[model samples]
Target: MVFMGIDIGSTTSKGVLMNEEQAILAQHLVHAGIGTSGPAAVKKELLAAAGLQDEDIDYTVVTGYGRRTYAEADSQVSELSCHAKGSAFLFPDVRMVIDIGGQDAKVIRLDSHGRMTDFVMNDKCAAGTGRFLEVMAGILQMDVSELEQEAAKATQTLRISSTCTVFAESEVISQLAAGAEIPALVKGICGSVASRTAGLVRRMGVEEKVCMSGGVANNGAVRRAMEEELGTEILYSPLAQFAGALGAALYAMEKAGKEKEHE
Candidate 1:
């Protein structure tokens, strides 16, 4: 049977199609433009990529910043729950999930059975999130993907004192004027973001076999910062960015099976 999942984040929207085994069949990622047309536009693009019309889906699960944005979905779910479900589906041993989205960051705790026990998030701040890194990237004239590799080449530690994006930008300018090494400054900025992320994860309580999800999970600098602060290893998924969508798909599949069983 086929299942579909849609994640409507602030910066990006992702849609996925999968089978009962959770094997991904097709997926699409698109920039989420400003306005009220979040899920509708994203779903249309995803449906096109999957080579199936929207009605062909067995069930559809929606999640992320715009969970309610997908009014046509069979069900709307939270990003935290979706990440837990999706990560566990891929890695059954996962006891923790760290997800960094465009505007928020979350760390979810799960039981041995993969049920969510508790979670913590920083939805109000950009300090520990992808947005923080994006601003830093702009200041450093570098991309997040390259930040970690550069950080690894740093010869000294550079300090950044501001947590606010605006203040941080000012501090970066001062650092540049002081002739701070570009690599060192970039490393410090990433370190600050990771430190904030570690703080959120601490609220959820650290556990083994942690899985990292969301688009920012693709960043090595963020991963290194998180691991350093948390003092634990992180497992990365190639499909990290689609965790919410994958979770939705899996949930839709299960719900469909139960419906059929009753019939």
Candidate 2:
């Protein structure tokens, strides 16, 4: 049987398909635009990409901030749970998961068996999330992907003291007006984001085998800064961005199995 998971996030939508054995078959990610339309569109795209029709799926699970709006899902799960589950599947020994998506960040603690034990989330603002980086990128006239590379070239360290997105943008503007080096300024921005994320991780209490997931985990500069601040080697999967979706797929598989057992 085929199982599917969909994550409708604030800034992106992701989908994953799993076979009866819970092995991933295909996964897809796309920018989440206005409302529920983005995830609905992504779900169709993933079904097409996997060469399967909606009828082929045995169960469908939905997750993330917009989970409730997805009328087609057989069930809905929390992003926090899905993230921890996905991180555990990728990194078997992972005791911690730090997920930074478009508008919020999460720190999840896991037990030895990969079950979520505790978690803390920062959903109040965009300061420590991908949106923050995008704002900084706009100020520097650089693409979000270029921020990490530019920060990597830094020869001097600069500190971005503001945790508020508005203030931080103003800070970047002021630095740019003063003819500050772009690379150093970018490094500072990455550092600031890392610091904010690290604070959340600290609140959850660090453990061995730390793993990072979500869109921000794709940024090399932010990952490096997080590693330094947390004083641990972090594990990342190429599947980071799709972790929540993958977790949802796994849950679908589990639910299907239980139904079969009862039958």
TM-score of each: 0.91, 0.96
- lDDT string for model 2 (102-121, tens) is 88999999999999989999
| Most lDDT-accurate candidate | 2
* Clash pairs for candidate 1: none
TM-score of 1: 0.91
| Deviation of model 1 at 18, angstroms | 0.8
The C-alpha lDDT values of all candidates are: 0.82, 0.89
Runs of candidate 2 with Cα error greater than 4 angstroms are 33-36
Residue runs of model 1 more than 4 Å from their true location after superposition: 33-45
State in Å the error of residue 156, model 1. Answer: 3.1
